[model samples]
Each structure stands twice: as structure tokens, then as C-alpha cells.
Target: MAQAGTFVFLDYYGRLAIERGFVKPEAEDEDENGEALPSTSGAAKPKVPTISHSAALIEDLTAHKTAALRVELANNPDVALVAVVHAMLLSVAYPYNSEQSALQLTLTPERLEPSMKNAESCKGLSAFNDLADNYGHHLPGNPAELFDWLLEQPQDIVLSLLAFGAAHSVNAVEKKFTDRKKGIEQANQLGRALKVNMPDWFETTGDSYFKHVNRMTIELSLAEARGSEAELSVRAAAKKSEAVTIADRLVAGTGWIPSPLRIAPSEAEQELGAESIAEDEQFPQAAE
Candidate 1:
């Protein structure tokens, strides 16, 4: 049971009502249309973390500044982004400030309730409560949405105010699952990998694809896999990336996922290539 039923305070408020689980916003509860419907009976309620100092913490993440982040948490532990990140930072805060600055550490989560009542008054609580526990990566809405956007944005976006584990979503990881730009299509190739050992929980409905990957990537992938060869309805236009996606899938299923692409050539590789070229250019001892 939660230590407290849910806090009713100035900065924080809500009733977790864990018995029913976490209910997302009406928008989150909506279907493809703008229409909203009541959830059916006996569905698992999602979990969302509760915390305080939400405004400052979210600002720190949105601003994407590490120093500012450290300061925010240092000044107020309750400002932590999510449980995982909070857990991590708590283990590393300080004695290193040579200047012995005015940092007063507090238990980040201590300031918030595991549950709250009437969350509306809270500034950022609802926006980020889902991220409070280690489960922040599992956003209530389209799970692939934020991560899909992240792929197009600079890598630094990962370090933005999400704090701690906010950036560690399955979707975030899927984007970096393979080499070069192939990572962008990692979701399309996921079914191939999953075929090796399907998850008991996985249900291959249309929504499954949307939950894990962007639309275009999945469509392009299906086109290659089942288009002309299998006569399945191809969903999108042709993409030259078909080969790269296939290769990535093959590599992914083999218990091997390549590391991020190296942008700069290593010194040894540079020298070896040059040496090989030089040797090829040389005549072999006048054929003696």
C-alpha cells in the first residue's frame, strides 16, 4: 500500500487510487477519432510516478542543461525527473564542490506522494507523473511518438530535461538498435527479430506497429517483405532503404546489434588503407 493514500498539498495533489490504477488524460483515453470512450472492465491500470517541484524539474529537462539540472536537484531533491534518474543521481551528488556551495540535499521523492488527490493544481505533475517511477519511458499516449520525433532531432535531445531514465524507452533504444540510418527503420524489422523468439505478451494488431514504430518505416518495411513477392497490400511508396532494412533485420535477429556508427576513421585504419594502396601500386621486384 502507498505510505500515504495520496497527498493533498499546495504544490502537489492527487489520489493515486492504485486500486483502479492510473487513468490517463481524456485525450490519452481517446481513440483514433477525437471521441472519448470509457475503458472496458478489468483492464490493467497504468502506473505513473508522483513527485514535487515538477515545474523546476521539467524546466531543467526542457532546457536541456546538465549544470542547471544538477543545480535544480541539488537545490531541491524533489525536482528529480523520474525514479530511475533520481535513483542514479542520489548515488552521485557531492562532496566535490571545492567551494562548498550552498547545496542542501534532500530525498528527491520524499517531497512528493506516491499518490495524490486532485492533481489539477499541480503545475507539471500530470504531464510527468507517468515518468515518475522507472516506467517514465512508457508514456501513456502513442509510445512511439516522442521517440520518433527524437530520431529526427539531434542526439542531444536525449539529454534534455527528461532526466535520468526518461530517455531510456524501448522506442528510444529501437532507434539506436542498428547501424547508420538503418536504426530509423528498426521497428519495421522488429517482427523479423521477434519471429526468432516471440514474446508471449506480443499481440500483432495494427496498433502494435504504431506503438513501437513510426508509420512510414513500418509501411516501407512491409512493402519489401510482402509486397510483390507475397501479394500483401503494400501500404506506402517504394523506398531505396529496403536493402538496408533487410540487412539490419538479419543482423538484429542474430543476437547482435551493431554499435553506433563511427564518424571519424581511426588512425590505424587510415594508415593501413594507405599502406595497402601503396603496396598495390609498387612493382613486385621486377617479377624476379
Candidate 2:
């Protein structure tokens, strides 16, 4: 089953993709004679490049329908997405590169070009050619920016690409990033804005914790969760499964859920003040 997320940014991103793909595109540029504009000095014009396939992807992704997203990709090929996928698969194809340690996160252009080219050939997507032509050596910026861009994508496939690309291809070439906390905060803020039903909104169980992360990491989490001394001792002595049981009650919800749920503001709240609407308009700055 497809997982729900905090931010629902597909609608805006989908529209952006369609607009870039067709509406008033640069390809429509014309001269005064109503003929296609000539490049300066009679030079051939470079192909215009922009993001694409967002709207189609958005339809499936917004609903968290991963299966539907694959069907969309099958019916309508997108080059950018293909490049993103094939490139990511290579990262895990080998043993972890722990020996050649560096903080860099993006794949080298030389290694990536052939893979993208192969996908472009297979998919028959000229957009891949555009992507290679323009951004083969480069990708979008930091994790926060990448996460922000991911939310803007319309499909689960596209979103997953950005996520994968950041960790695999894009990050390989990029330099070591320092502000991990900011990226996390950005994610939390986006989740809150999008109104996602966060998994953690449920009582955290040993199963959820042990499955995803190393058990020792719970020590830090316990500290942040403000567990009791007894709970801390439990975390130290008990298995991760047992530790999480105590940890659950110590933590507050992450704010993504509508906790302390209640009705929205009443008409009296909407009125806000004793002054009438017209009176407020007359004294424009008074409310401020």
C-alpha cells in the first residue's frame, strides 16, 4: 500500500509541469513577421528545458497510489523520471563504498551519463536528452531544497526519484552538507502545513522503532523524550522492543495530527472585535 505523507504539494507542482511542457512554452517564441525567431547571428537555438510530467504523476501521488503512478509512467513515458530511477538502482548495485569515505553525495557525471543515455534511448524521451544536455554535471541544491522540490512533484514515482536522487546520485557529486537539523525542521514544518496523519501520531511501539533505526539511537530519543530514570534504565537494559514501550508514553505527538481536536472558530470569534466590519475598514490600521 502507498504511504501517506505530510505535505500535499502535488496540485501546484502538477500545474507547473503541464505549463512548462506546453502552455506558452518558449518553443512558441516568434518574430515580428510571425515566423519562429532566429537565434542571434543565425546560430541554432538550444532546446528549451524545464520540468515535466508533474501533473500526470500528481494525480496518483497525491492519493498515495504508488500502483497508479507506475501505470501512468507506463502509459506516458517521462525522461526525467527514467533518468532518476535507473541512476538510483546503480547506487545499491554494489557493496557500500565505506572505504572511500567522503561527505559528498552526488554521482560523477562521467558515470551517470551512460546510464541516463541508456534510459533515454529505451524510453524514447527527448526530455532525457534535455536533462543530459543541461544538468548532467549538476543537480538541484541541498536536502531541504530537494525535499521541497519533491513535494512539488505530482507522482509518487517522481517524489521517490528526488528522494533517491538526493541520497544516491545527486548527493554523490554534491559537497558535504552541515545543516542536517534545518532539513529535518523543514520536513516537520512542511508536514504540519500539509496535514498528514503521521505514523508517530499513533503510540510508538517497539516494532516501529526497531524495524527502521538502530536500537542504540533510542538513547538520544529517550533523552529528548524526557523518559523517567526507570525508563532510561529500561532502555539501557531491556531490548529495543521493551524500551519503546516505555518511550511511547514519554513523548508528545509530533504536531502533524490534529490533537486536542475541536471545532473551528465560531462566528463570534470571526467578528474578532467589538467594531463592525465597516468600522474596521474606516479605522484601517486599528486592528494592526
Candidate 3:
């Protein structure tokens, strides 16, 4: 099933592949006057070196899906759910290097554990266990050399991760409904953490599920912004009301609320009227 899906994807890629090098316009047998041409001296469309299918896939895998091929892949569950997941992480665990030492590292048991207690210690661990568990096959030597090895990663593993991401986004939205203020704060914090913890992972595998995740993320940001705007509006309204209240009281001839340092007019006019009041008392010295 996996091999069949891969070839189908490859066929799609081949059709979309661009031709390499400058495309010369059809050589004219004759000039505009219908006479034999002497020399070929017209500017040609610069041949863009054909981008490889793998490179195109990588770009589509890393960027927004603008092509028709991407739209088809998104709709097809078999290809969308499995092949993309596998390809996104294809070179992750086992890097393609010719060194024999790197090849031998593939035999480590920890490397083989998907749910390892210590992921760092498991580098190059042979995926023999995955094969035994029907999740993946152990590549005998350098696994990176063979495309077949990548095609064999367990579909279950790929699908499970995709489902988990989708569910997490849904859960985040639900949390905001129940406790909006804290929820927005928490979501923003989590988004920032994801940016920090998995910067490279996001860059490579982000496109695999970006469309599924981007909408909810945008909502979270907009919700937070709305909350902030509401708070600011309330404060501005409150200040406006206070100013109106003071103006009304003044017009009515009831004394307005005094400044923080001043007593009401009764206390202020008497002492303030005294011409002998010390300058130090009128304007208190600053505290040391």
C-alpha cells in the first residue's frame, strides 16, 4: 500500500516538473519579410535549471501548498495521512552520511525506541525493533541510502502524530471558551514554547499539517487582541466619566474633589491665605 502510494505521488511530481536551461524560441527559417535569416540574434527565455522532483516536494513540504498537486494530496487521506508524515521526517533520525561510524550507530537499541526514556542516547539505533513490531524495517547498513527504508515507517505512527496535533488544537480552542482570559494567555505561552523547542521541526514538518493548525492559532491571537482592546476601551470610558462628573459638580457649586495633597476649600483658603506661611511648609522638602 505504501509503495503504491509513493509511485502515484512520483507520477504527479513528474508531470509538474519544469524543463531545464534557456528555452530558445523556435529558430525562424525566415525573417518577418519572409526572406532567409542571416543570423540568430534574438534574446531567449533563460532556461531555469529544472528543479528536481525531490526538491519540489521538499519546497511544497516546507511552504504553503499553492499547486494543484498539493490540493489533491490534501484531499486524499491515504497520501495525506501517511506518505507526507513519513517524508517530513525522512532524514531526521538517520542522516545520510558515508562514514562507517555513522552507519554502525544505527544499531543502538535506544535509537530504535519510539517512546524512548532517553532520546539522545539512542542515536543511529537500528530500527530493528520497529520492524519486529511491524512499525518499520531495520535497514542493514546505511538506511539513508535506500528510499525503500523510508517508505516502510509504520503508518500507525504517522497517523497517530497527525491526530494528536489536530486534537491538541481543538482542545486549546475549548479551553479558551471555558476560561477565556487565562486560556488566551496559556495558548500564547504554548505557541511561543513550540517556537522555541521545535524551531527546526516546525520549519521542515510544519507544512504537513499547517493548514489544519493555522486557523485555530489565528483565532487565539485575535481573541487575545480583542481582550486587550476591550480592557483599554473600558479604562478610557471610565476616565471620561470621571472628568464629566467633576465638571458637573463644579457647575452645581458643590466643591469638587480636592487634589490628593489639598484639603477641601475650608481648610485650604484659611492656611493658604496666611502670607507668613513658611516656604518650606508650603512646598514640603523631599524625603531623604
Candidate 4:
């Protein structure tokens, strides 16, 4: 497949939108019939100056250096143009940093290499490229245009965001599934390598960890929306946890303490039908 040029569609769409006033007003010469006229009797019509979506996005983002936007950029450095546009909108709507930094990190070249085997990665990149191609033509000069363009987008925008996981997982699955020699062991090996080598790339927080699980459920629910069954698994693995969180009590000793020895149940536990023994399993304690 021929590689698409960066910002080509953005520039083309932006120029079209600007010329047609779909974005913002641009000076145009026209005749009484409302047909665009030549700038000079002998000269042809002047081609409109154009800007890329990235350029336009940066321009719009630069206008709002609000505190909220600053904080969001700090959290998710990968969220380029869209984050800035969202920040500006919030500044107008609530007039404060009502929303925290919710941007996702960018996938750098090094990061990309590890996830290259994941099929979902290709799917995501394809989706982004396709989306950029289609919507690239709908550059909105202002927030209104942006909003309109967003509404016109397919409902799978959310899926696109979640698709990143599946994309990253694709490369791993391919190595295991594609090669004749590779088998289930390859998947296990790749899974372990991914977990250890790229901990930061996967879910590393309590809330984010939960979100990954939820995203897996959502992926299953939207199975038909995804491209294939492989994509479903890729999405699931993308949200998988890399770190093993050992309990404090477990870590305090040899990490081999029995579960029954962990804690003594309170009256609340008995009321809730929760199994409760005692901190020392050998001796039973009365509920206080």
C-alpha cells in the first residue's frame, strides 16, 4: 500500500472549507451571477491559500492557553490537535478547568516497534488513516464547524479510541498465529515480553486498570462493530494488566501466607455473609 502523506488531506479539505465558507469567511472575487471571477481580466482565478488540519488545529489551540488545557497537555502529551480544541471548548462552556487531563500518550517509534506484531495496531492505524482521509475534507474554521464535523462522524469514534489496544495486540498475535513453527507457546512468550518490556504502555494505574477491563467488556459487546474475532482478543489483551500487585500483608512476609490467616471478620462481615475467620487461623476470634 502506498503511504499517505501527512496533512495532505487536511490541507486540501481546509482549503476547500475556507474557500466555501464552511469553516470561516475567506475573501473571494465573483461576478453578479455569484460565480467566482478572475482576479484580473487576463489572469486566471487565484488558488486559495491552504492550511493543514494540524496547522489549523495548532492555530485554534494557540488561541486558548487556559490553565485547563495546560494541565491536560501535561497528563497526555500524545493528544495533539484534538486536545487543544477540546480545551478551548471547555474554556467557553464552563469557563474553567472543569475537565482534567484525559489525553492518551502518543506511540513513539520505539513504542511502535514492540506493538508492530499486534494486528489491532494495523487496524487502528488504518482506521485513523481512513478517518483522517474522510474527515480531513471537513475542516471546520471554528468551533461550530468542529462540532458539526464531529456529529457527522460515525458512532465508532469511541471504538477507534479503544481500537488502539487491539492494534497493539495484533503484532503479538500474528507472530504466534501466522508462523508455522510458532504456536501457543509463542503467544505466551510474547505476552510475557510485552508485559515486562512495555509496562508503561499498558494500563498501570488502578482506575486505568479498571478501564482496561471495562474496555474489554465493551469490545465484546461491540464485537460486530470490530473487524474480526482476532480484533476482539487483541482489544482484550491491550487492556490486560502487566504488573502483579501483591497485597501488603503478602509482601510483608515471604508472600506465601495463607488467605485464611489474613484478617479476622467483624460484625459487619457476618451480617454481609462474608467468610471470616481470624488473623491467626488456629484460634477463632469472636466478632466484636
Candidate 5:
């Protein structure tokens, strides 16, 4: 019974055998009906199911479909953009009825208020609010008229609205329990394309950065921004709070951006490097 793959059927058959008195229960070790029952303490474990033939076939078929769809979508950027906009609108405007959009993409706009201290007073938030308000003023007051209004709008207007929606959809916030490396990588790609200068938008201070990090991190930041002398100065501060204050004062007006906040290397640079490597391989340099 243990050798068979169907453990459930074995359990059923074992119960039936016990009811008919063919086999005795383990508790009745000294039953006179038959020889002493063997101990079940080292029973054979059930076998785990591997990939089935049907499952493998389905996977192969779906892979072909996925590849074909990807090619079609890549060739039709206009359709892809529209699909993205439609998906985003469904997520933002009709969250409960998001299944209306055919696209499987999900856009969850991160709420920064809960995570960031003094988020309400943030300059970036203020700018975003202004943009939202400007768009809101142009939009229809009635929810029913929104679709018609959007349809009647110029292509540029529609694009502007789409950009706003896409911008809000961006989520680069790192969480404790989840690995969001792929999301962060995509965000960095977007940043590089936009030539984003982080220092222009955000000024790192005790409240924003230093207070959140440990004393060592603060010292390291100072060392990078100023020098080893500045690092030593911060280290002299006995308490972490004192170190944070000293570091903040020293780092101010330095236009120093944290490593995480810095823009990633552009795609063009990566392509150029790859090309250079290929050329180098084709024509090896002669060593002097």
C-alpha cells in the first residue's frame, strides 16, 4: 500500500481492512486474532507529485501564445499605450471594478503619508498636488461626462493626462518583508531616461535621512560628502542624536545625494560599453 502513489486510496483500504478484522489497530498490539501488529512509528512517507504530462503540455502551449502576444504588442506602441492608460484608469477611478480592463497589469499608487515623516509638507508632494489640481480644473465635474470629455480632448491633452496617471503609478518604496529589486531597477531606468536630479527635488536633512539611519551610516555619508575629517567630527558626538545634528549641518549646501537616490547608468552607456567590448575582442590590444 505504501509503495503505491495513491496514499488516500491506501488509507481508505486500510480502514476497510481494520473494520473487517483482517488487520488490528496499532493500539491493540497484543490482539489474539492474529500475529502482533508492527509499529507505525516509521511508516513510509507519501510521495510528492512532480510535473504532470498535461501540465507540461499546457505550459509549452501558453509559452508560444505569450511570445506571440509580446511580439504583437511591441510592434503596436499606440495600442500598448492605450491599454496601459485604460488599465491605470480602471485601477484609479474604478478600483472595485478594475476587472473591466482587459490588461492584467496592476498599478498601485503608493501612499507615502504613512511612511514618511512630515510627508504633507514635502515640496515634491506640493508640486504633484499642483499638477493634479491643474488637471482636475480641466476635467468634467460629473463622473459620467469624463469619458466623453476625454474622447473630445486633443491628442496632446490626452497624453498629458496619461503621463500624470503613469507618474502616480510609479512605486519605488522599499519595504521590509518584500524584495522589490525588479521594481526599483525599472524605476531607476525611468529616472535615467528623465535625467532626474534628486538634489533639486529633495534636500536630505536630519528629519528626512540622518535621523532614520544609524550613527555609522551618518558618518559614512558625511565622509563621502565632505571627507574623513568631517566623519571624525561626527564620531566625536557621544549620542546618535548629536551625531545626526552635526552630520546634517556639515552635509547642508553640499548638493550631496545618497547612493540609493542617485540615477542609475543610462541604457545608451551600457550599449556603448557592450559595443566597445565586442570591438576589443575582434581586435585584441598588443601588450608592450
Candidate 6:
């Protein structure tokens, strides 16, 4: 699989092996008898002491907290939207005063052309570009004149522009050797708010998804989307290529998206306020 050669995959597999005790590091400066050898320089070696938490455990705990935070933030879109706008404006209009933005959110838009072939042809990209062009035509050409132009615009227009800019700043793309869990959680929150339907935008075919992954992944996806019968059909294929084809045909129009791409269902807006009030009453300090 093409993904297997990536640094993320390699690092994940290596860490998994270490965590499962399938591999162990060799001790330094020792014989098979488990005795310490003399220092080659005849100098004393300083004692090193250490205390560390399990990286896996910490990651698990923090992930739960991050999920909770995302849910709470999503419950209050009015505040979240304002924070996003404030952060975006500070970064662009007042770069030197960026620290004043309480959110401390950094927006670095990623270019997908290098990684995804024909990325410019994507419908989403085309729509975004058209929106950007429309805004460009209305905005002042000179950077210095932009502030005055923004001030002249109505509240709705300004808010629309703010939303557009904030949307552009979203960076949900994952990278090799990088952690994007928090970014992804926020993106999912935004997706839920917008009621994004991935099936409406993209289709998963052999070229799009199945062919790139291993046969097992294809089988698993087929199982989830089309049931055990479809998975068995794929598994019975003589070659991985054939399996991919079978999977592609079987899963077409099933409206089944990979777990990573699916957005979590949001809680009822009417109940969110009540839940927050109850939590505040139960833990006043935490609410503060």
C-alpha cells in the first residue's frame, strides 16, 4: 500500500511493536552476564534518574478531554464564530497585536495540489475559488484602504466576509509525523454545524480510495458498507487488484463514508443550554 511507506505509518507500526513488547531495546555497556563494564575513559558515569507517564495513557485521556471541549464549543456556535473571526482579523489586520486574541488560534491554509492529483478540478475547490474571486472583486485593491472599506460595509456583509475568511483558514488536512487531532475535532464541529454531507460531495471508487489501500482494509470497508456477503466476495478474489474492483462496485452509492471522514451528530440545540446550566450548578468553579 502507498500509505505503508509513509512516515506516519512507519512511526505508528514501530510504536505499536514497542508497546506490545514485540521488540525491546538492548541495554548499553553490559555483558551477557548482566554486569556493568568499565568505562573506556576510566571516568565516573553520572547517575541519571527519570520518572515518566505512559505516553499512550496520556494521549487517551487528553483525547477524551479534547472531545468534550469540542462538544461544549460546538454547543455555543455564536461564541465560537466570534472567536474565529477575532482570531482571523488579528492575524491579518493587526499582525503585531495577534497576542491580544484570546483564542490563540493560528490559521495556516494548506495547499493540496502537491499531494492530490487534479486537486484544482475538485468541486469544493472550484466553489471556494469562485467565492474568493467574488469577494476579491468587491474588496479594495489596496491593503491600507481595506480597513476603511470594511468599516463602510453593512454588518451582514462584514459578517459574511468574516465567515468566508474564517472558512478559508480551516486546516483539517492531516500530515506525516504531525498531530492534527485537535484541528480535526474543530473541523468536525464546523462540519456538524454546517450539516456537511460527504456523500453528496465525493464518491469512493477504486481510483478514489479502495485501490490505494491494502486488501484487508478494502474487505473491512466492504463489510461495514455492504455486509459480510460483500466482504466475502472481495476476500474470495484471486488478487488484491480484483478485490479492489469488487469492493468499488459493491460499495458504490451505499452512502458509506470512512469513519475518519464522518462527522459526529450534534446534540439538540434546545437542550444544550439546559445541560450547560445544570453542569454549572453542579460545579460552579469549573463553570467559572
The C-alpha lDDT values of all candidates are 0.39, 0.44, 0.38, 0.39, 0.74, 0.70
Q: Which of candidates 1 and 2 reaches a greater TM-score?
A: 2
Per-residue lDDT for 1-288 in model 2, tens only? 011112223353464322132222223445567676543434454344445667878886666775666566567655445444434433332234322321223453224445331333333235444544443333343322333443355677565554544433321111255545554435444545556454423334344342344556665556544545634654665566666665554443632212222222334655775457768788778444
Give the per-residue lDDT of model 6 (tens digit) for 1-288. Answer: 211121222342354221121211232355677677553344343333334579998999888997887788789865556556656655554446567554668765566667675585566778888887787677655554555556566667768978887776777776676687887678878997798998876778888788888989999999999999999999999999999889889999898878766776555753897798999888778433
Worst 10 residues of 3 by lDDT: 1-10
Question: Of 1 and 2, which scores higher on lDDT?
Answer: 2
Q: What TM value does model 2 have? A: 0.22
Candidate 5 similarity to native, TM-score: 0.60
TM-score of 1: 0.17
Q: Give the TM-score of candidate 3.
A: 0.21
Lowest lDDT 10-residue stretch of candidate 4: 242-251
Model 1 local distance difference test score: 0.39
TM-score per candidate, chains pooled: 0.17, 0.22, 0.21, 0.17, 0.60, 0.55
The residue-by-residue lDDT of candidate 1 on 176-254, one tens digit each, is 2445355444533553444523323222323223224554555554444345532123332254244334433433323
RMSD of each: 27.4, 27.6, 28.3, 23.7, 18.6, 27.0
Give candidate 2 misplaced runs (Cα > 4 Å): 1-77, 93-178, 193-195, 199-288
By lDDT: ranked, best first: 5, 6, 2, 4, 1, 3
Residue-level lDDT tens digits of model 5 in 1-288: 221222223342354222122221233344466675566445553343334568889999988998898899889876666556656665665447567655688777887778677887688788988887787677655544555566666677778778987888787877786688898788888887788888998888998899999989999999999999999999999999999899889999999978877877777888999999999999999999
lDDT of 6: 0.70
- What lDDT tens digits, residue by residue, belong to model 4 across residues 55-125? 78887777575556777657874444444444343332222342433433332212344634343544445
Top-lDDT structure, candidate number? 5
Off by over 4 Å in 4: 1-66, 70-105, 109-148, 151-156, 161-288
- lDDT of model 1 at residue 91? 29
